[model samples]
Target: MKTSSPNTLTEKLKSRVVLIALFVGSMWAVFFLSVALPFLHLNEHGVVPRSLDGLQGILFAPWLHASVGHIAANTSGLVVLGWLCTWPNIAGFWRATIGAMLGAGLCAWLFGAPYSVHIGASGLVFGYAGHLVARGYYTRNLVSILVALVVVSSYGLSLLFGVLPIYPDVSWQSHVGGVLGGVLAARAGAGAANRVRVR
Candidate 1:
């Protein structure tokens, strides 16, 4: 009988500063824009424009949002999903992060629609959701599967609605793009994480 003693990618942290820093930093920045400078409309400069003629849209768009509510929603999702996506395997963690940026940027480029300035890490959220689901199935890990299910259940109860033309003004294309980014990243990183476990 084979006993399953899988290698742990990351044991609980010696200090929570790194994670807390990321979490708090994300929240703080978002809140600053939402509450502090929202009246000033400080984010007009960083919308995810349909065209990436300048790198500003690609680089800074995700950080800016249309409204305080928009930033707040994305911030909340980030606080929870950001940690979950990166907390496990070190390899997968980095993969997801890079992949998410790549995915969001790609989505912003491809399906941004005309004059449809997009922004926020929702694309990255979709990217993480895609990563969790794909990683779970590929690795045959129950945790990944449960995570995928939870993502589907909570984050996207109306996954198809997000994909289809159910809601106007919302870019489902970015969501799809993020999913593609996540799949690519998870596929690449899964093997690497598994390899580390076996070694």
Candidate 2:
């Protein structure tokens, strides 16, 4: 039940465009650099469950991908869902992102299989989707709700499958954690986008 004026909305949109650019651009940059410098073994930096060293991955894992294809698969969701998250405000986007990152990494570290190193932006993608969907329900905003419906219609089935343990190669734990994080963000920022008077 919050509304933003045309000018405020425009500014928010513009800010989000820049935020997304920096986001995707950073991902691409890291991927290219990792490819260029194979010896860096960037993939090794991902979260490894129960390992003290893996804790750092909580902050770095989302920026690292297993391969070009992996990052490509997450690119669309990151852009689209990320955009929707920012539609409310850049602060909300950051809140969701940080929460998801921590949630996914922590869960993967704690619950993932031993000797496994989980990596990729998929957790963040799931987080973005979760935030948008849950934000609608929590805030009861028509636009947010519509965006949620559209997301559910477009990627609901796939999202459902991603969280299943059937996929050996995927870290379903991360997916679950990411979603929980998004929901947490929505709850934390419930009043972040409340209706405001336009001057």
Candidate 3:
């Protein structure tokens, strides 16, 4: 059986790291650009509940933020959880991200206050966490289970509280929707893997 050499594995790891860095870098870039050009009003692009114009936020909201503190709060979660999603394969990472974005955006639009605009990568961060945890449940593998346990131990409280509507400024709807999306993605991925194995 031919296997990847050490150098190849190292290269693959480096590539994945670069991908994560680029993604996070893009978020920072957007934040700085929005700050520098306030006239652009980039934040206005965020999900505006039930408004026809706000539908665009489904694709743009995850890339927008209100302030440095807002983006900073989400940065660490995105970096750590995003890196975790890249494991086993890179396709999984995209699945989680896209799923999270759509789910979170839709939920915020559906459930958010009538006049409020929801923005932030917190939804995606929550989505990554949800994906990792659900992947363990669906895959029933030792590595996945270990990863899930780590997530639970580290983020259990946040995950629980984040979905509740206790904080007026926070979008619990997005977090809940992101988690649901991540779980569904995990289920879909597991089903596809099972079919592939069966064939």
Candidate 1 lDDT over 141-190, as tens digits, reads: 78888887887788776455665656876767667766777878888877
Model 2: per-residue Cα lDDT at residue 79: 94
Residue 119, candidate 1: C-alpha displacement in angstroms: 0.9
TM-score preference between candidates 2 and 3, better one: 3
- Candidate 3, number of clashes: 0
Residue 139 shift from truth in candidate 3, angstroms = 0.4
Error at 167, model 3, angstroms: 0.7
Candidates, ranked, TM-score: 3, 2, 1
List where candidate 1 sits over 4 angstroms from the true fold: 1-17, 20-24, 27-42, 47-50, 194-199
What is the Cα root-mean-square deviation between model 3 and the actual structure? 1.0
| Residue 127, model 1: Cα distance from true site in angstroms | 1.0
Measured against the true structure, the TM-scores of the candidates, in listed sequence, are 0.76, 0.91, 0.97
Ranking by lDDT: 3, 2, 1
Candidate 2 residue-wise lDDT, 122-144, digit = tens? 99999888988899898888998
Model 2: colliding residue pairs: none
Poorly placed runs, candidate 3 (over 4 Å): 1-3
